[model samples]
Target: MYAIIGATGHIGNRVTDILLNKGEKVRVIGRDAARLQQYVNRGAVPAVGDLKDTAFLTTAFQGATAVFAMIPPSYTASTFRAYQDVVGISIATAILDVGVTHVVNLSSQGAELPRGTGPIVGLHDQEERLDVLRGVNVLHLRPTYFMENLLANVPVIHDYGYAGSAVRGDIKFAMIATADIAERVAAHLLARDFSGSSHEDLLGQRDLSLQEAFTIIGRRIGISDLVYRQIPYDEFEQALLGTGMSRDVCRLFVEMSEALNRGLFAVNRPRNAATTTPTSIEQFAEVFAEVYRGAQHRHAA
Candidate 1:
């Protein structure tokens, strides 16, 4: 059986759907049974429990041949890195305890760096935690900036008529669709071809600056004058806090933006067919438009 942690998440949900459609035996682990109910109805065995609980995770992973794992975001985490460490340790410990043979772990582009990349440093630590294990094969999938991150700008655009962040608007970086990440994870889990731990970079279709991305998003959403602004770091952190994120995680986000502005999160590998995926920003703009329109309608209502 194949097990998927974060089964209710963007990448995990897509991975589960793909595997289940292929008639694979899937054990979907998630915190919300209501959210996982759809997968359960579709023939997935649900392991509903807390991610930081090693026993729960061990139980969830016990019989699966391969597992897809990630450290899910915790917006309200009082100490963000501590929360990440707990979740990461639980996952690694569970894998060791259960003797799961294959693992596809979700890591980030800046994960190679041990510090100064904010929450990404947690991923680096997690990679280290798993790297020491002797028997199980692991593949760390390091994906670049997510296109869906743009969705976070929806409220800002609606309220202020502009898009902005602490990261530089002029810097071009790989922006990938999370769907593409899911495809790579699912393919690896199904193939199970590698014998040792390795890492792969998913660089998306190409690189585009935030300004360039916003232009495409503007055209699709009928906002021809839309532009991306570089908000001051303090302002960005405050905005994040206004969204109910704890100050600790908000600070980490600001640190991540500083790292991004310094080019720390840029694609680390050459642009090759293997690193590049099929989804384009133009295609993702359609998804952006639908979301933008939905937010618009909700505001109007």
Candidate 2:
């Protein structure tokens, strides 16, 4: 049996579907039973409860051969690291209690550094916490910038005619599609071949800058010249706060952006076929275009 935490999430949902389609028994874990109903219809056992509760997670992890784990994102936590520890610690403790032997942890690239990487620091600590388990085999997926992240900028581009973020416009980073991440994850969970604690870098097809990314998106959305602007650090933080993010989380995001600008998120291994995945920004532009049109329709409505 496979246990998937955050089962309705981007990566987790895909992993669940892949396993279920292959006739594997899956226990889908999430906070909302309603959101997990679709998976339940497909024969997954629903384990609905708070990720912050160790007892709840211990129950969820019991009877599973392997587990896919992650700490869901939080925008309003007053103290971001504290919130991470609440969830991360619970996951670790439950794994210890239940003796689930295989775990696939969703982490970020800059997690190599213990600090200065904002939310990624939490992932760094979570990796260590999971690694200490005596009998568990852990695989930490350190993926690069997600293409789905640019979905957040669609409204801005639709309203203001330009795409922007805290990232430096010229700095290139590997951009991945969540589907590709899920594909890698499903393969590992199905094969169960990896032993001991280790990690793999999923750095999409290649590196791309925000400028290049916006240009591809522009073509798909029918814009001739879509510029990607680098928002000033203070302005970006203020905008995030205005969107109801907590001051602590906003500060962590700013620190991560600064770290990205300095090229701090580095890969220890050389790029090769094993580390690379198939999705490209050009293909992802189709998804972006669809979202942009929906945004336009919403404004008109």
lDDT of 1 by residue, 136-227 (tens): 89999999999999999998899988899998999889999999999999999999977787999999999999999999999899999998
160 in model 2: Cα distance from truth in Å?
A: 0.9
Q: Which lDDT values do the candidates have, in the order given? A: 0.93, 0.91
Q: Point out the worst 10-residue segment of candidate 2 by lDDT.
A: 262-271
Estimated TM-score for each candidate: 0.98, 0.98
Q: What RMSD value applies to candidate 1?
A: 0.9
lDDT of 1 at 300: 95
* lDDT string, candidate 2, 53-168, tens digits: 89999999999899998999989999989999999999999998999988989998988798888899999999999999999999999988889999989888877999998989
What CA RMSD would you report for each candidate? Answer: 0.9, 1.1
